[model samples]
Target: MRTSPFGRTALSFGFFLLPLFCRGSHSARNQTANVTLDASFVVVEEYAFGIQGVWVQHREPTNCTQSPEKPRTRDITPAQCNRTCFPGSFQPPRLSDCNKIIESLLNNNTGSLQANPHTWVYVYYESCVAVFENPDEDSPTLQYNWAVLGANVKSLVNSCLSTPDQNSIGGACVFDEYDGKQLSNVEVAVQRFTDFDDDHDDDE
Candidate 1:
């Protein structure tokens, strides 16, 4: 699940480009390291969903001993982590579009979640990408995209649509709740699968 250099470069470029329209402040530029970008999967004319994020890996110390000479404590950081989602493998569902949808709704003064209770949101992988979708029947569509450095097309169906096993990459699902703190026991099964740029205003 190594991230391709092309993907990394595209993501890095996307990071710097996002700040211009996002916050339009000096802080936004410096905050790229922690920034999360929203994107969608495009599936013909029916559905397009994706996640809004950057796959970030934070290092933690290990508990394994480096050598017998020192007899010191070491830590084995699991290569797999919940915070990090890699391409080509369905890591556990680490990203969600619930907040993004909520934010979009609020920005347009779309009232509250209670007003529109029939909601479904999720994050899935397609053609190596981790996509999240929340379609709006009431409004015109908007386009937001991000490049996933290590996306792959393996098990795109099982991970997203079929009943996944212990090793499957099926996405995480959330419902009407804006915070999405309470997760549904049943993950949303998608029947189909398919599917950014930035300018620093005056700068590149």
Candidate 2:
């Protein structure tokens, strides 16, 4: 599948993620708005169906993890297995939204996100659109070029509680010189939660 440039723009900042529709998912555009957005954000609306006024293959949502296909090839970090649970990549976390994926499919309101585990998908909701009114609310942060994402997942996600310090868990993404300073910064954030456990807090 050709990844959208709009998607590139949205995630380039490590924020503002959007989703793209696949090619087989397009048919004809129904009704849409003409909202000029940055090239990066535009990919958020790019779909097989084309942009607004273009065709959109209609179907309900599908389970992103329903398939057994070995999930998208992912690069794991050395620190990956160090902790019992790593924070999930996506935010506003909702497994039920995947259920909504099924609902949208059944209603034929929009095309489903065909994916297996490890592949993160997102779509804008009607309510969200009512606010921004932009068609690119559905963000597929996982669809980002594997190379960039792989790198971020490895280093960017390295926030862990520090050793020796009872309060800090934020650590450098890897075993690098930078880890010490970031660990120091966390000493400040820990002030908020006196009992906060950066990695795994054991106590009162």
TM-score to native of every candidate shown: 0.19, 0.20
Worst 10 residues of 1 by lDDT: 16-25
Tens digit of lDDT per residue, candidate 1, span 105-157?
22433111111111122222221223322222231111212221111112233
Q: What lDDT score goes with residue 50 in model 1?
A: 26
Model 1 vs truth, CA RMSD: 21.5
Model 2 C-alpha lDDT per residue in residues 76-194, reported as the tens digit of each score: 21212121112223221122222222233234422223322222222222111100011221321111222222232223222322222222221122211121221110000000111
Looking at model 1, residue 29 earns an lDDT score of 22
**Residue 50 displacement in candidate 2 (angstroms):** 16
Off by over 4 Å in 2: 1-36, 42-103, 108-112, 115-120, 129-204
